[model samples]
Target: MAYPDNLLSRGESVVLSKRPHWKMLVLPIIFFIVIVGGGFTLAAVLRNWEYHTIAWIVIGVLGLLLLIWLVVVPFLRWRTEHFVITNYHVFFRSGILHRREHQIPLGHIQNMETSVSFWGRLLGFGTLIVESAADQPLEFENVASLPKVQSVLNQLIMDDKQAHRGGPQQGGYPTGPTPAQG
Candidate 1:
């Protein structure tokens, strides 16, 4: 999904936007299938019973509840969570009803690393840990293409620092006139 441009500052542009990897939904999908399949099976088994209709109703209600709690909620959380990289900052936003957003300026980021387990490496997703100035490291889990993300973030941070120091920048223009030139 596209990150909302309205949240960006003027002149800022999005570099990357992604949600958690599809692996995050595996359990939810499994639960969904089980709930649907079990509900149908139970309904079929009760078809000849005296209270079959009532049993089916109960099964339907219980299945719906289980699906909503185990599948729908997780799906919504995964859908709403966003990991975005911009020219100026990195953003993480999550929550369904009440939103929570956190941003770290590229210039403020001091360190970054990627952690990939054997399964993660085989699946092409891992965690990205971002450490900003004087702040706790923020871990973005199940990031797809983690190595690429880390590489891009490193480049952005370098470029941000260069621009702020009035040095050579990505677009071959200094951010502003240096005091020495003025």
Candidate 2:
């Protein structure tokens, strides 16, 4: 989707919006299974019929809540949280009930780093740390396609710097080799 023209100076364009991969839900899915299994076992083990019924009802409810919290919640969060890279800035947006957005202009970004653990590397995902001149650093965690996102950010930073040096005009920002290309 086109970003508001006013948000960009003249030539800025959005590179991509990185979302948490579906694979990130693995842990939550496991948790849901464990909770549901445990709940069913507890309900089945009760000796008294009345107690068994009550236990089953309570456990069923608890299991449902756990499923909602573990399986559904993270999925919703992954759906909601967006890590957007534009030619001018990086935007982190996340919310379920109350929305929150954090934007860091390329000019204000002092440094950027990406970290991938063994599992993350195997899964092709990682966390991105964006340090800005502002006090709080922005973290884009569990983002899929890490290399592409990092390269886009690097290009944006370089392009912004070059624009400042070259004098601004209305046109798409220059594209260059991503880190992977190097």
Candidate 3:
């Protein structure tokens, strides 16, 4: 889904937006299949029992609880999580009930690094480490299209730096004459 436009500043525009990689849901989906299949198999086995109706109810409740706690919660969290890069800032927000958000202005970014294993490269997903002017670096894990994301952020940071300086500055001085010189 598109990042909500209202979150951006007046002139800011989104460059990239993504949720965590689909790999993050693999375990949860496996759990769902196992729990659901096991639940159905157990219910079928108990069909001939004298207390079959109560047994079915008990199985259903347990299955539902397992589904909600394991499968449903992770899916909700995945859907709610957002990593957005704009021309001006990088925004990360995630949570279902209680939200956590972090915004780093593009100009504040000092360095960036990406880590990808063989499987991650094959899957087109990896972790991005963003070191801003802040003391500690922030790691964004399971980022989809990690290389593209990193490249876009690099470009945006460069552009932001140039814009703040009123175009690219060379050496240790401004590009043009100073006010006194002018």
Candidate 4:
């Protein structure tokens, strides 16, 4: 699903909207295969036609449960996940059963890093790590189009710096009272 428009602050523009890369699905796919394989294997072991019928029924039910628990739940969680870079903030939201949302304002961001292993680079995806002054670091794992995101973040940080410089400095020596100069 697309990122929710209502989630954006007024006047905030979206720069990038992304889901976790397909590479993240690898483990879930493998889990689905294992569940199906085990189910079939069990059914095959009960060779008699009469026993086979019961085994297939039992296997089907058990397989469904396992698929829901190990494969479907995670896949849905991945689907629900969203990573958004906005002019005002970086947002990450995810959850299958419970909703979670985190945002770090552009002005508060201290650093941004990109990482790609050999396989990740080959696959055209990597992780984006964002460090903010007021919040914990965030690691966006297996994000596609990592280079583009990094470039955008660099631009945003530059813009933020320029914005800060153009504004009046917020704090310094006390304005209300002056120490006796003499």
Cα lDDT of model 2 by residue, 9-31, tens digit:
67767788777866877888899
TM-score against truth, every candidate:
0.90, 0.74, 0.90, 0.82
RMSD of 3: 4.2
TM-score of decoy 3 = 0.90
State each model's CA lDDT, in order: 0.92, 0.80, 0.91, 0.85
- Order by lDDT, highest first: 1, 3, 4, 2
Instruction: Predict model 4's lDDT versus the native.
Output: 0.85
Q: Kindly list the per-residue Cα lDDT of model 4 for residues 1-182, writing each as its tens digit.
A: 88888888899988999898888789889999999998888888886677788778888998999899889988998899998999888899999779999899998888888889998889889988889897778888889889988888888877777677763243232434446842
- Which digits, one per residue and each the tens of the lDDT, describe model 3 over residues 1-119? 66789989999998899999999899899999999999999999999999999999999999999999999999999999999999899999998899999999998899898999899
Clash pairs, candidate 4, are none
36: Cα error in model 1, Å: 0.6
Whole-model lDDT, model 3: 0.91
- At residue 57, candidate 2 shows an lDDT of 80
Clash-forming residue pairs, model 2: none
Task: Summarize candidate 1's per-residue lDDT along 113-171 as a digit string, tens digits.
Answer: 88999999999999998898978999999999998898888889888888887677555
By TM-score, the candidates rank as 1, 3, 4, 2
Number of colliding residue pairs in model 4: 0
